[model samples]
Target: MLPSTYRDLLRTPGAAAFFLTAAVGRVGIAMTSLGIVWLVHGRTGSYALAGLVAGGFAVAEAVAGPQLGRLIDRYGQGRVLPPVLAAHAASVLALLVLVAEGRPGWLMAAAGAAAGASIPQLGALSAARWSALLRDGRAAELPSGFALESLANGLAYLAGPVLVSAVGAGGRPEVGSVLAAGLVVGGGLALAAQRRTAPPPAVTGPRTARSKASAAVGPRAGRSLVRPGFVVLAGLNLAIGVFFGAMQVSVAAFAVEHGVPGAAAPLYAASSCGGLLTGWLYGLRRWRAAPRVQLVVGTAALALGCVPLLVAGSLPGMGVSVALTGMAVPPILVVATVLTEATVHRHVLTQAFTWLNSASAAGSAVAAAASGQAVDAFGAHGGIAIAAAATTAMAALAAAGSRTFGPPAAKRGGGFGSSAPKRGGNFGRSGGV
Candidate 1:
């Protein structure tokens, strides 16, 4: 049975509709990311091109994220999300047409660039929306919501590819393309339903106001997203990213080298399973404990979890290491997320989220190449050890810099509820960055 908080919150205003809409839409977006690569790769017969295709999405997303987040903060999500998703959907369709029509690789890459740049900021917006909802509602349900959302996000990764693979087994190249489209439309509709539920725009207090102003004119200007606490978290996250990204490439390379490439699946599955369990469990942990406590513990555990990876010389061993390490991820991410919402002034919240997106992408981009090279130079054990060290260091840093993230603004404490925000598109209620 669903809990009282969730059921009650959804029943109010447009919150319920938005929640349903987002979940539905996310499923589609998730599939695009998970399965699109294999589909493109299978057709192109060039891993380099495939990598470029994949990298293009990351680059576009990373480069454009802050602007997208800013737009959401400035204009509201409903105004921006649809068109972006549509453009993305159209690009995927165009790419499929090009492939079917025998277009050159350059053409496909070009098409990919357009699609990638325009991909909706749905992930961040959805997260922010949830944060907004939680800040204004009952605090008890807040943790559970984050936990459920993380699990759902992971499930999207797990299921997107499996579903695509299952559908493709019937020998239809267009199957993946069609599935991607269906998901886009479905997700788009779901997102649309939740439009009314967006919390009132966060109003910037003097601190954020001064920060924003200084960002425009001062020596340290132009980085409105870099709040001190946010900086600490982001810095730590970058290290974490390096660790995870390196592991992602290195793990695959290690398995393939050992002639047991299939073994990677078990480790990956174990990680996801652990993430699923931890996400849900953390919700029951009670939100009253200091956010930093959660942040520190989660990150420390995560770093420690990576320690096992250093000793794993085989598939089963790797799976155990991976699962244990995976346990630390959801909590770290969820804690960071909740903190970002709770602390950063509302006006700049979206920007902070985008900065995070950029961090993840940048980290992945660096890791993809560096990890492979490290493994080549030092062997898998060396590479894994390095990954663990970096991850642990990040956790320690987050612990040291924990003080910057203050308690939530009193007005912003619970998040949005069943009541429609009094000022539609006002973008001034919660507070700005």
Candidate 2:
């Protein structure tokens, strides 16, 4: 079933109204945080620099993400959010001030880093709350919510970069900063409006072995935050990250290197949004087949699709190559999403999501910077090759981990879901049976 009904997402629970309120805030925060890319690029006149700044933001968020999720799990959102929001506001304001003050590139990078680090827990925290509000069995709601969030992500990809480029071209990076600041402010206000609506947080003190094992979960899954199925999922994600990061940098860098730098934004936006349009349905597939099968095949298909890029000769070819590449992304992301939601405990679900998301960020930060520099030295195809190598390495890891990664152990307090490689929609395990 679809996660929350369309009406349900709009409705507020008696005590969890805050979740709905926070959703709006999340949208604003995402929209505006991204707006800074155009702003910063307009100021610096370097796409690589813009990417670095954005990568810094993503890196800080990725590094701190698991820790932040832990914080939310350890403390109530009420206790955690306000101060972080305040600090976030201050940091962004500092960034704005520097922009206005005409700060040097290094100074801008430093300010962006601080702001990115302090950007509060808007998206991550909001997701946690959404799951919580669905506690009274709106389970379908959560997945749909996620799908909608995914769709929203697509919208942001389309709008944020385009909007920033438009405004930046008007000769004002400050405009982008101002737009980011305004969204932050509005998001804060929206979240404040949600104070009374959110569900109580589900964090309990860390579950010790016996106590946790006593629950309905398998013994292994009951203990570590990691689970067997989740390992497979995360493992696949690790490779997927290399693919995603490499693609991002490759597109941007290739566009510039190929003399169609202006084509970069639209090409990526089309690729992502177009793929996402398909992802929603992919998520809705009601796949009774094992996710392991889907995962391996998905990864291979994605990888194969990427191989076409070696021959991309024009702006149009670039777009086609990217769009085909996009086809691989959603299946992996959605399958991972399903596997994780199915296998993970509810209390730590947000943290699980956060951790998985962190993997991609970690990969992107490391790969984007490395690949960007690689292109400068090795040229576009060489960068592409390196990226392809990185991604293949990831796929190989998932394949190796497949032995241990299987269906959740059946016995009580057993282990993770079973992970036997199957046929058809296989993920990273190649086409093997």
Candidate 3:
């Protein structure tokens, strides 16, 4: 009933095309952020300036994310993505040139902002494709589909750094920016070409010209902002991001204090590996718990898992603790995506997703800055304690607003229900247990 491996997902028509396309975009996402930081720091010789440029890039993305998503929702991926990718690539190239030529800081910031504003929302769009393609009667397949996407995202983070290191060898940081731009152009185009998976444009009533244009704009007119459920989801994602950011710095500080700074990457990779394994197994299950309950329980457990990090003095102990904590991360993300899918309207899914992403990004940025200061003042233990506290707060919020996550599909009477009238034709009947 569920895909055992990603290969099973690949066998589904159009799934392979879209997944591979998403992988390309994910790789670009993973490389570009790190690449920009390295390039700016190397050229400017000031960590402050580097941080400022990187912050500008992220801030621009946070500001423009939902607006770009709304455009994609209104115009279709094919029409919207190509121009955006072109602009994004152009902006990156401009940044690359400015850094290479040692241009002033303001110009660099402007270029970084442009790059962020034009960057495509590949993850959100990919998830939306899966939701649209697997809807109607194949609802049971949705979990496996989302799990595969999550796994791909994890793999991207792992592989993207390797690509950046290879390209930026011998301190050639500019090379990574070029490579990242290439990935964006090639991947974005390929993803946009999968028109079969693209969500259909919003339906419009035949009437006044103004009404037609408004309908075309649809979610762009700010419908998603008015929803309380979506706002809560955004806050939840932000908390998760803060937890992740603090944990990351804490782990790095731990490695450095123990005189094996290089071990930090391996320790982080161990956690990602745990997440990847759990995500695969999770997709194969037919769960009894509602998604909202799962979210609350999972977040609480994750918070508790972080407790070990504070006491894990040895490197191996810290690695073990990190891996255990990471096992909870993928499921939380998968559950969040599922809830967003269920709660938001179809027309505004991209916008809703972008809002969640923006919130998370902002939280991570704040945590990274704050945790660094804490680590400097009070050591790695302080950072770990802070991370645990943030996770605890996240758990509390999840517990209080579990209802916003929405009821599970099985319990909602519309999905794989025991008494749902057999509809959706061949796909529906074939998927029936």
Candidate 4:
């Protein structure tokens, strides 16, 4: 039976509102990539141009993500989120208008990049809220929270493209972007209203030995951006992104080769379904292995699962392989989220998560370019080889970092939930939101 942990978490003040809003926003963001690609292809009739513009959007987002997260860390979410989201909505509208009006490709790419850069770091923000709320003895509940995030992400990928296609049905692709903008605006406002769960900012001042030492060594309250532990964790997520990107290209290529291009969606859906089911089961039980061990083991399992892809000849065979391979994905993500929370101070927690997000985006961008070349030269086999190689690299890195994952060296009393935030900061006084 699935545990009622999610229900219990939802029962907490503001959790339900925040999560629902986050989900709506996430689904909208998911739609943008496919929508952009389709819109560009429709306008230009060149797959190369469409792919290039889409790549530019992803690259811009990856570059801007950390900087935005830093702003959110320094200022509070309520202060920082609304303006960025507004800009994002405007950018989306601009891109849709330009595409519909047959504007130059450069102009379209520019607008798309703006929209991508301004996408609210909703996943990272939600995790940080849950981290703040679950501090102290309730820390064990974090795995369940992270699992919920994984489920949301899986669902978004599964459903978002469908929504985009439906909106674009019968020659109306621009409607998709309009709908996405509305969802982003609505969700951002709703989440920003929930100031009660916002984490306090970390102390920033002239560097001291204690601060420097804590940053170098393990201390939960240490400045996390400087820590090697967080760097390694981010690297692991980057590798996971490479595997994901390569697998996607490989699946699309395989489906095309089999003369069933439409089968790509079902094949990808199989993987998402597998991840979603495992996420539910994973959250039902408390974890035992150290996060480091789990990261290594989960990565290794993913690589092993992909081995079947080498022999998969038909769509059904590939679908089964993809599903089995995807089962290992959510656990790695959940462990990575837990590790990020453990290494970073609560104040900068959102920034740390955004760094991971950036790393993943970078990895995906690199993989997409490389996999495209490989698929053209050596077909789907080459793409699967890339996926396997990336996962193997991730496993190796995780194993090397195993000894580094543990409780912080210096003990900080109480939890972040117990810390009193400074007065006159952004977001004003906490309310029932």
lDDT of each: 0.65, 0.58, 0.77, 0.76
Q: What lDDT, from 0 to 1, does candidate 3 have? A: 0.77
- Cα RMSD to native, each candidate? 6.6, 6.3, 5.0, 6.8
Query: Regarding lDDT, does 2 or 4 come out ahead?
Result: 4
lDDT string, candidate 1, 282-330, tens digits: 6555544566666787788877777768877777788788888888788
Off by over 4 Å in 2: 1-56, 102-110, 133-142, 188-199, 202-223, 226-232, 252-259, 373-378, 397-433
TM-score of 1: 0.83
Considering summed lDDT, which 10 consecutive residues are worst modelled in model 4? 424-433
Order the numbered candidates by TM-score, best leading: 3, 4, 1, 2
319-389 per-residue lDDT for model 2 (tens digits): 88888877667656755664565455544545666777777666655776677787788777666776577
RMSD of 2: 6.3
TM-scores for candidates 1 onward, in order: 0.83, 0.75, 0.89, 0.88
Compose the digit string of candidate 4's lDDT tens values, residues 1-433.
3355789878988888888888888888788877787777776777776777777778778889877887787667888899999899888888878877888888888998998899877878788788777775676677787888888878887788898887666577667777777777787788888898876544222386654543443334335567677778888878888988898899999999999999998998899889889887887776555566667788889888888998898888999999998888888888777766666555566777888888887787789779989999999989889999998888888888865543333224555633221122210000000
Comparing candidate 3 with candidate 4, which one achieves the higher TM-score? 3
Off by over 4 Å in 4: 1-4, 43-49, 203-223, 406-411, 417-433
Count of residue pairs whose backbone atoms collide, per candidate: 26, 30, 0, 0
Better of 1 and 2 by TM-score: 1
lDDT of 1: 0.65
Candidate 3 structure, TM-score to reference: 0.89
Q: How many collisions between residues are there in candidate 1?
A: 26
| Highest TM-score model number | 3
